[model samples]
Target chain A: MAEASDEQLMLAYRDGDAGAFETLYARHRARLFRFVLRSIKSRASAEELYQDVWMRVIEARATYKPSARFTTWLYTIAHHRMVDHWRRAGLSVVSLDTVDPPAGDPGPQRHAEAREVLTRFAAALETLPPAQREAFLLHEEAGLTAAEIAAATGSNEEAAKSRLRYALAKLKSAVDDG
Target chain B: MADERDPKVSRRYRELGNEEPPPGLDESIVSAARRAAEHPHAPLVTPSGRHRWYFSLGAAAVIVLAVAVTYQMQQEQPDPFATGVSREAVKSPANGRARESAPPAADSSATARPEAATQAETSGRQGAAAPEARMRRDEAAARSLAKPMQAPAVETPQRMLERIVELRKQGKHEEAGQLLAEFKQRYPGYRIPENVVRP
Candidate 1:
């Protein structure tokens, strides 16, 4: 249940407990989906890659090990799948044009000013390079540390740190301009 | 790790993060996971499932190799009893034609003139038929193989039983009993009457 760690749940799934997999999926689904959604920036392609990541998890459950943090491995698979998607789609630059902004209302009756800032946040995210945005999302969404991000994305820790710094700086600048 | 006091940026990221994926996509993803867990070894409907064919291919290769080995051993030494061909004729082709024309069956005491028949006496193949039995077998084989259009029917166990019964009735109980013993050893699977076997 809630007391079990992600690794424990995954190990249980590996031993053929389907409920354990459902628990793991429920725990991480939102953050993982957001990671893929914001990384790819296209609802259609994001869903495609999102489903693919989970399928990879289920397929690899039998071989699951405790070698690394579960989140680290999950994000790593996500990162690699994104890389493959981009490679196949001819290296199209990751841009804000990928995900359409929310149509009319800023959700849940937040103040107009905060809504504008959130919109700017989404736009700024799309503007950043895919690598930078991914590092930021891995930190904020998956709650991975800089070292974990580097492990997931196959970059040095400093590089992951730099991307997060650049991403946060750009988003701050976008908000300040507003 | 930078600006710990930046509530505004953190708050804004949380707001955008609230943008949940569509419920339909969530349903599809979870359903797919359940399906995968249900059948871990089944290839997926996706592109990855194609890899399972390697298992089937390996099984097929083992089957083919086993069949090939069995067939080769059979060809190297066919069943002489089953084929009605003399072992000497099979082993020595130079004497094959002579064996083919000989009437050993017409006179079991006088075997075929094929040189291989003479060599049968000295041939040291273990488990081979005894010399006298082998000569009579050559005649039985010739009668069966050379006159295939009217090949004499092979002796049935019942016919052997009847002959043994006659021998017993003729006061040659030892010979009849010995032959009965041989018949019982050869036809263990046959359900013969115990009274007839002993009598």
Candidate 2:
């Protein structure tokens, strides 16, 4: 059961194998959490949206087709839920190229200079435009390719690639400056 | 499909730490999934797939109904030009031009005219009743001319109720009562409105 692919687990669940859902949820819970958390930057909202995404998966089990990778389907739901969240809040993603990156905390809890670089890196990530941040997070956290990122985000591959490239460049600069 | 992620960015991103959702959130989601799986409601369908089938079926039904209605209407109708046949010419036996034109009356019903029928009998004796074979075309045309062209609108239940209400307001008790009886007979199970039921 543990060795089963995500698609197989989802199919089993669709066919009324209750235990299959548990296995699938366990496999994705952490990465999906981090993905949602990083996208929203609000722990409360992220948790709520993350749970909603899974419930959507459950509700949509009757109609699920294994046409695409299960991960893409899962993240696409996450992406749409986040988009709805932003819409309800009357927020829009804006270009952050000109906005000055916020200062990093480099919390005293981290004793090493390397830990300070990690803190600065986290801060720089927060400053990126929502689109770029999402692309970067999907790439790093979900292990999605440029093509997969486009699939999840509903953007063209070129746009996804451009956003990820810009995100990597900005984060790299932040590390170098640290 | 290529891996475009930068190694340095990837390393730094990893160092940002793996933040997991709280235990409670995970439990709630997993419980929901299990419950749903155990008691499945129905399989989901893609909007495109479901709507395509429904739209296709609806469109096909509409087309078939339209064709049936058109064919039925056309069969019931006389040739529009049949009404244009000169009644004066059919009445006056001296109209040589009308007689010549009337022999080629295209519709079979055109022979139903009295004069045209007489011509049909004469031609039948000669076994050459080519166009003047109908015997009642003029009678049907005359009946059609006596009635109004447009059909009256079909009375729906709601419209019938409104008419009954109008009749009641006008104090035509006898007519309203008769119409109300007819309405009830037509719609055996319609719920009478409270206002219409009163008085």
Candidate 3:
């Protein structure tokens, strides 16, 4: 069969096609797991939440809609789940200090200086307000446009733009000052 | 100050953004998705239908028990003052010999109809409380029934797709598209061909 679109795959899964779900999961899983891992800062929690998110998708299969990009919807679910987890755990909304970039493989040549800079970058990300950080990640990491980010986050275009701008400024400052 | 800033900073930040996530993440996610698929009917993030059923059944049982108890109590006790004879009088010897043998205090007590009336009024007040309890039971039943019986309609691919179309028309195309993709993946058999998505 021809490769299906994300929406098509979701529709297929809804109709009891397990292969479609596997396709969808294969396509978006890494990015989503990384997204959650970055936000929550715990591998175990990320794994648990990751499982929870997919389970939600499975449960929601019957009602899956083609209204948004599958990835966006998936991320939104992940976002909400992460927020709920944080609330239940009595943790504050992610702070700026906890945002780390994807971990690099350990190597002698990967200088301590680069690691320090990346660590600072992560911290700066954690410090951003949830909206700003989400906007920045969607734009910078996911390659979404400001308008797209706004739609995913349920914010207006202007607000999304403002968040991106703020996130960039903060990140720049953190790198420069460090 | 702005002119002094290095353009490389932005470039470097952007470059760092694209770094691939750790290996095995995708496999882990796929595993999770597989696990989820295996147990499709697990309870939702919110309460499940079974929980609601249990609640409804429990409420019904309580109401039935309360009503039965009330009926039994009503049947066991007859109206006191209206009968014009003390329960004690009926319980005593059937002949006039018992009355003749009864003390004057007993006769005075039997004549106190007002007190008996007051006691009956209190019983009526107690009965009146039952309706309020019954009303509460009814309300609980209504509430249990008020919740939608099945999973919300929004969970369906068609509904989600419709919502996406609406959002798209409203210039929320990104979100609309995202939801559409998610829905499509979840329900692969229900393809809304790209051409017909808008119409």
Candidate 4:
């Protein structure tokens, strides 16, 4: 069961295997949580959106197809959920407008010495345009390539690569500044 | 091409540490999935199931349509006994007068006969007499229409010769002559009426 591919687990779950769903959930929970957490400004909203994404997966189990990688499929749901959240919050998803850094640090425990650099990176991530931040999160957290990122975010590979490049450049500069 | 990942940026991003959903959230989501999977019928329906539902509905609609069409066809054909009654009513002069007097009942009797008869039958002795009377009138009308007096009698040679004499009396000499010639051709062995010969 542990050696089963994500697609295999999803198919099993679709066929009424609850255990398979638990395994699949355990496998991607952390990365998906982090991806949603970094994409949005509010921890509460991110938590809600994250759970909604999984619920969508549950609701969609009957219709789940394995044409794409499970990670790409999962991130696609997360990406769309976040986009809906941004739209409801009246945030511009397409604009490259930078946002104010969220209040306090939005990260887990870190080494005392590395805390400053982590803070700088977290703040920089929050300030990035929504598309670039999503592109970066999909690439880093979901382990998706540019093409997978494009697929997840419903963008072309060129745009996805550009967003990821710009996001990495900004985060790099912010980290170096520290 | 522009899809390069910077090692320094990656390291810095990793330094921000991993953030996870709260344990409660995880439990909620996983349990929901398990509940859905375990029950199987509890959550979203499959496309195949939806198609089956549509098929069932469509089948039901077709069955209903067939029944309705059959019923309509049945209604369109005249009932033989009722057809006899309507024909007598139209043919007999006395029944036509009766129908004219009861215009509304006559107009709707073809469709409403069974209902009116049933109602009258169940309405006790007084009301029962009405349908009985209607039945009696219908029978009488049918008998009158079937009587020999109502039938046209076949004409005989004597009647033809008398008709020719009448035509000659009415100053139709040429027509009378044509009829005499035809009578002679048809009944050559019979003697002509003296009145026809005089004409």
The TM-scores, one per candidate, come to 0.54, 0.53, 0.50, 0.54
Ranking by lDDT: 2, 4, 1, 3
Residue B101 C-alpha lDDT in model 2: 51
Best by TM-score: 4
Candidate 3 reaches a DockQ of 0.09
Cα lDDT of model 4 overall? 0.72
Which residue runs of candidate 4 sit more than 4 Å off their true CA positions? A91-114, B1-3, B43-199
- Report chain A TM-scores, every model: 0.86, 0.86, 0.81, 0.86
Better of 1 and 2 by DockQ: 2
Task: Give per-residue CA lDDT, model 1, range A56-106, as digits (tens).
Answer: 887888888989999999999999999999887733322434333344565
What are the lDDT figures for the candidates, one per model? 0.70, 0.73, 0.60, 0.72
Rate residue B137 of model 4 by lDDT: 46
Name the lDDT value of residue B61 in candidate 3: 100
For residue B192, give model 2's deviation from the true position in Å. 46
Report the lDDT tens digits of candidate 4 across residue range B106-151: 1213333545334444554464456554664455445545542432
Model 3: how far is B134 from its true place, Å?
A: 31
- lDDT accuracy of residue B41 in candidate 4: 67
Q: Order the candidates by DockQ, highest first — what do you get?
A: 2, 4, 1, 3
Better of 2 and 4 by TM-score: 4
Candidate 4 clash figure, as a count:
0
Clashing pairs in 2: A62-B43, A62-B44, A63-B44, B111-B134, B111-B135, B112-B134, B112-B135, B112-B136, B112-B137
Q: Which 10-residue window of candidate 3 chain A scores lowest in summed lDDT?
A: A90-99
Candidate 1 segments whose C-alpha is farther than 4 A from its true place = A90-116, B1-5, B46-199
Which candidate, 3 or 4, has the higher DockQ? 4
Task: Provide the lDDT at B41 for model 1.
Answer: 66
